[model samples]
Target: MEAKFQIFLILLAVLAGTALLARRINVAPAILLMLAGIALAFVPGMPTVELPPELVLLVVLPPLIYSASVAMSWREFKSNLRPIILLALGCVIFTAFAVAAATHYLIGLPWAVGFLLGAIVAPPDVVAPLAIARKLGMPRRILVVLEGEGLANDATALILYRFTAAAITTGLFSLPKATGTFAVIVVCEIVFGVAVGWLSLRARHHARDPQVEITLSLITPYLAFWIPEHFGGSGVIATVACGLYISWNGPLLISSATRLQGIFFWDLIIFLVEGLLFLLTGFQMRLLFEKSKAFPLEDILIATALVAIIVVVARFAWVYPATYLPRLISKRIRERDPAPNWRTVFVISFTGVRGAVSLAAALALPLALPSGEAFPHRDMILFVAFGVIFITLVGMGSGLPLVARWLDITRDGRDEHRAEHEAEIAARREVLAAALQSLDAITDDRRLSDEVVKLLRARHESRTNQLPDSLDPDAYDVSAAGTALTRELIAAERKFIHVLLRDGKITDETRRRIERDLDLEEASLSNREFRKIAL
Candidate 1:
């Protein structure tokens, strides 16, 4: 028990170091974490960490999916639903079949085994590329489309994976039955996921404690995933649906305190889990190398290189036609949605970097079939899966920022800020108008004093006037300037407090209390400023 606990701490410490290093170097943490894990694998006294397939599927995946789902923009997702569906469902199926065909012909794997490999790598992992994408200042629409595809594609890929693995195990295949089952699983998962989200939201509304509500938020995703999956449905889809449903209704249903706390908690959870998962993927290298020793190293390299190229090319092939074909065929689509430029399409196609889902699916493969023999080409599949992840994640992710710069597709925040400011101004005016009407009604009552009514009306009118008008760009500039100045003042106060602490002018307790107040002010300033410019 002591040794096990020590090993866990060591892994965490390594993860922390790698994360900090990645940030300092401006590389995505996932790439560094994987590299760190690989280096650690050869170190003396390093414990081998093996994650069982069932655990990865059932335990590791649910919360990650939920956190992503809750943070996703429902409005943006719906707006790009058509292309998202094409990439998620259509592209996923197409990639699986394409890769399967390539594997069967080039690598000479059996059709069922080849398809299994396809299914494993089909869904691109959103975590690594998204972190890089945000830093690269990629367009919001492209980010939304990518996120939606990642969220939705896993279900499709995993379903195909299950059917292919089953075919391999049973030595039988049925296309019609498989198609019917896939449809049923998708529909059932969505229905159950929505129910979980709705009930969780309702529960949150009635809860008095913020802590309890946060706890419920943690459990909601797992419940969403487990319930549907228990009945032979895709847990991945269920978790995403639950997250989307709750996120869409969050503003109205959740308290401000609960929302803020939940965001912090989930963000931390995701960071730790995501970093740990990537690092663990690296740790699997020794095992993978051991398993592949029977095959010629040159042959394995050829297979890995071939599959990686195929997956990359397949995404480009699917993205262009899928993106433009709809607008070409449908007048309604053309009118409703303007086609994106070739640059945007190229970015989307190039940035299909695979991550945890692919690794998890590959690791989750059974050690043996039902016939009690070793799973055919399992070693080769695992090797190739990792190859694809490394190539795509490190290779594509590293180049994405450069591509964004070259294409001049980086977001400037002007459009987003303008729209947000307009909405804020409208809301401010509405509430102030309502306040004035209430003051008038109170002034008419016999119990209300003229002095109180006059004071209330003056306050409301002043506030209404202070709000920036939509037509006056100068008002927005002034408001933003004031917020920025306030932030500077807050920073000055923080510096003074630190100096006081450094000089021992105040006790640690006193310094902490003063700093807390300063922190709150800074936080408020940040929130206001973020509304104006933050991504």
Candidate 2:
């Protein structure tokens, strides 16, 4: 237990350090963390850490999915639902078949085993690619489609995986029955997820205490996930639905303190979860390497290369046609949504980086059949799955930025960003106007004192004055300069407050209250500055 605790601490340290270095070098932390884990695994005296499949599937996944769902804009998710489905459902199934065919014919694996490998490697990882894509400022729609697909694709892949595994174990298969069961799972999980979200929101609202609300927030995903999963469903869609429900409804019902504290808490939790996940994924290389001695090295290499190539080519083949063929066939579809730029489509196709979920799925494969015979090529399947993850994460993950640059997708997003900023500015002005009108009505109804009315009006006016007149580059430069000066002033104020405490002039509690206000002001300034530069 002590040794295990020590190893965990080491992993956390490496995670934090590698993440910082990755940020400094402008690379995705997932890429660096994986590489770091691999290197650490080979170090003499480094204890081998095997990532438990159940740990990832049952424990890690729910929170990651739920948090992402909560963060997603429900409106944007809805608008891009078609492409998301096409990629999540259609692309995943197509890729699985493509891999199964390629492996069965070329590599001489059984049909079920080949399909199992395909399902394991099919879904592009949600974390690594999005981190890189967001940094590259790929158009909003492409990110949405990618993130949406990532969120939901696992359910499709995992369900297929379960069915294939069961068929291999029992030697029985039924397409129609499986199809009906899949539909039922999807429908049931959706309803259950939404129900969970509604209950979670109401519970949090009633609690009112930030700590308790945050605790309930932490429990939300597991409740949404575990119940459906216990009954043989994937639990992914349920968690997603629960999160989306909370996201869309919780704004009005949730207390402000909970929102603020929950943001930091969730952000930290996700950071550690994602970083450790990638690192552990890298550590699995050592185990796979030790297991590789069981098979001819040449055969393992050939199979790995074969499966990796097939998954990559399969995505390109599926994505291009799936993107444009609908428009070519249906005028109604064409009229409603025009064909996206080819470059955007290419970026999406190029981002099919497999992640840890694939590894977990592979590791979760049963060790033996019911009759006690070894599972067919189980070790080889694990090898190929990890190989696919490494090849995609290290290969495609690294190349995504260059691909976006070559295709000039970031350049195309400039106008979209500018327009978005314009909309934001317009909304800000409109909201302030509404607030002022409400203030006037309240003042009249309450017969408020002149002093209170004047103070409220002045506060609102100051907030209005802070808005930039326009998104002109010069205006942004001036705002940036002013913000920098404001930060320096705040820093000086903080220093003076410390001195006051040192001199016994202010109590610790009084110092904290003053520091909190300064911190909020500084945070607001930083946020405004980021918005200006992000355009």
Candidate 3:
């Protein structure tokens, strides 16, 4: 128990240190964390740390999927539904088949075993590449599609994995029946997921207390996921459905306090989960290394290379056709959503970085059949899966920023961001105008005092005046400088507040209230500054 606790602490330290270094170097934390884990694994006298398959599949996945689903904009997700489905459902299946064919033909694995390997490595991980792409400011739609695909593709891959594994175990396979079951799972999970979301929201809304509401929010994903997964369905779809339903409906029902507290809570949870997950994924390198001695190094190398190359090539093969063929075939699609830039499509293809899910799925494979025979090529599958993850994450993840820069994708992204900022300013003005109108009505209806009315109007006016009229370079520079000065002023005020507290000029309760106000102001300033930099 002591050793286990020590290892956990070590992992947390590595996670935090690697993330900080990655940010400093402008690299994805996932990439660096994985590398750090691998390095630590091979260090002399470092105790072996095994990642439990159940821990990932049952424990880690639900919250990760739920958090991402909630973060996604339902409007954007719906608008891009067709492309998302193409990548999530169609592309995943296509990639799996492509892998199965390649491995069977090139490496002489049996059909079922090859397909199992395919399913294990099919879904692209959402964490690593998306991190790199967001920092590089890839186009918003591409991010949506990629993120949407990441949210749901695991279900497809896992289902395929189960079916293929069952076929190998029982020697029975039926494509038509499996297809029907797949359709049923998709439909049922969506309905079930939405139901879970609706219930969760109602529970939290009535709970009212921030602590209880946040606790319910944490419980939601597991409820949506575990039941379906227990009954042989991928919990991913259900969890995603639940999250989307909550995202679309929670604002009106949820208390502001809960929302504020929940954001920080979820953000912290996701950061730790993602960072530790990648690190542990890298730790598998040592285990795979020890297992590799049984097989010839040449065979493992050849198979890993073949599958890695096929996964990359296969994405390119499917993405180009899937992206454009619809536009060519249907005028409706073309008119409603014109063909995206070829470069955008190319980036999407290049970002098929396999992640921890693949490793987890491979690790979860059965050790033997019911007949007591060893599971075919189980160790080999683990090796290849890890190799593919390492290759795509390091190779594709590192190269993505360069590709985005070379394609000049960020130019359009910057324009879009500027437009968004402009829209935000306009919306602020409109809302303030509406508030002033409301104030006038309230003043007359309630017969408010002249003092109160004047104070409210001045507050609204002050807020309206804070919005910049333009996002031009000169305006941006002025805004930036003003914000910096404001922060320095706030820091000075904080120092004075501490001095007052030290002199016993204020009670602790009074000091806390003042500090809270200052904190809120600083937080708002930080948010604005982040947006300015993001733009």
Candidate 4:
């Protein structure tokens, strides 16, 4: 792994550059960073770097998934949890088997190795899409589905991959045993995850300060993951469960200051982990390429294509049926929302993209068997895995915009028009209605003593044409930057104080004063955002 300080600086530069460029080009910043990392790999003198598999998978992945899941609106997640799990577990298994069979026949790889590859590529990278989707006004329903899927698919994929990889290595395949193990892994992971989350909340309850509370939350993910993995269970599942538990319990047990601070703290952790993984992919992967210098490129391409096909097709199978699952049970969903039309299904199906998890799982394969013989076709695996990532990240990256546009799924252009039209109309209506009402009531009294009414009449009579939907922009813009970030900071500081007071870090009197100050600041900030949007 690269030095922490150097990695941090590099990530900052990458983030800043990507942010600026994304604003200019109007695309996801993460997409830009991924491309930049790929480009950096081929440049001279940038030493190839390999991230430790444990660090990337265990250390980086848990918090990354947990943070995203924790931040999700629980109401939405609870409603959509079934479909998301189906997509993650059911779909992943389907893809693995489908791809495994396809790879065995088409590419002539061992069935087990083929399954391993399929499992690797099954999970989606929801982070990039979620961040981009927010700006695009993506429906909350879709966002929750994607978030839940990403948070969970790893457990399915990793467990399947582990068993399949072990069988491939030892030549001891057992379907019944693997199935049994899978069941155990699922149960243990869920139980352990809930346990860790509960304990973390308990610790926070007794903590002495907001900063300490936040730190405890930070440590919980890794702890949740390690404890489960050490016991031969799915760490991924445990961590996600823990995250959801704590998040759901947060409003009740956590100080508001701790709650807000914990979110941003985890967010930064996720950003760094995701960013560094991509960068390391650029670096460490070159070694595998060099070691496999003689591997044929055409073979790699064929395998990648086959694997990609299975991954996409599995989602279609899972989603088409899932879109209507609400009909099966009562109290399961909010309402009988219309099923996703074919166009929407097409977009959702194609959302499958191989990413960091796939790459890490593929790379984690042992180089040689217990007898010291070389792993079968290891180079081919690497080549295809890397190829899949490249094609998916870049190829699918380029296509998403086109697909969205064709489906008329984009909200940007329409939203702007609606907003602009409404603002103009509302402003006019308010001003003119005020003026006319004042004039009509004051005319008879004006000669006697109607000065105040005249002033009111002047204020109201200014405008006749007002849009019913529009509001004044002036009322919204409180800060130079939008209310989104500043308001959050105020709330966060308030949370810190709340945690402090609860944990005995601060006196109730001081805490009240600090909280009152924050409440005022946050209220003003929120008003500004509303005003900005309304105007």
Clashes of each: 0, 0, 0, 17
Give the per-residue Cα lDDT of candidate 4 at 124.
Answer: 78
- Tens digits of per-residue lDDT, candidate 4, 311-409, equal 777778777776666554554453545566576567667777677777788778898999899888777777777777767776776577777777766
Winner by TM-score: 2
lDDT of 3 by residue, 130-185 (tens): 88878887678888999999999999999999999999999999999999999999
Candidate 1 global TM-score: 0.88
Q: Which digits, one per residue and each the tens of the lDDT, describe model 1 over residues 291-351?
A: 7889899989998898888888999999999989989999999999989888889989988
Q: Where is model 3 poorest over a 10-residue stretch in terms of lDDT?
A: 526-535
Global lDDT of each candidate: 0.84, 0.93, 0.91, 0.73
- After superposition, the stretches of candidate 2 with alpha carbons farther than 4 Å from their true spots are 530-535
When summed lDDT is taken over every stretch of 10 residues in candidate 4, the lowest stretch is 462-471
Error of 2 at 429 (Å): 1.6
> How accurate locally is residue 359 in candidate 1, as Cα lDDT from 0 to 100?
77
Residue 39 local lDDT, model 2: 99
lDDT of 2 by residue, 1-535 (tens): 9999999999999999998899899999999999999999999999889999999999999999999999998999999998999999999999999999999999899899999999999999989999998888778898899999999999999999999999999999999999999999999999999999999999989989999999999999999999999999999999999999998999999998898899999999999999999999999999999999999999999999999999999999999999999999999989999999899889999999999999999999999999999999999999999999999999999999999888889987777788877788778888988999999999878979999989989988887777787788777777677778989999999999999999999999999999999988988876655255444
Candidate 3 shows a clash count of 0
In order of lDDT, best first, we have 2, 3, 1, 4
Which of the two candidates, 2 or 4, achieves a greater TM-score against the reference? Answer: 2
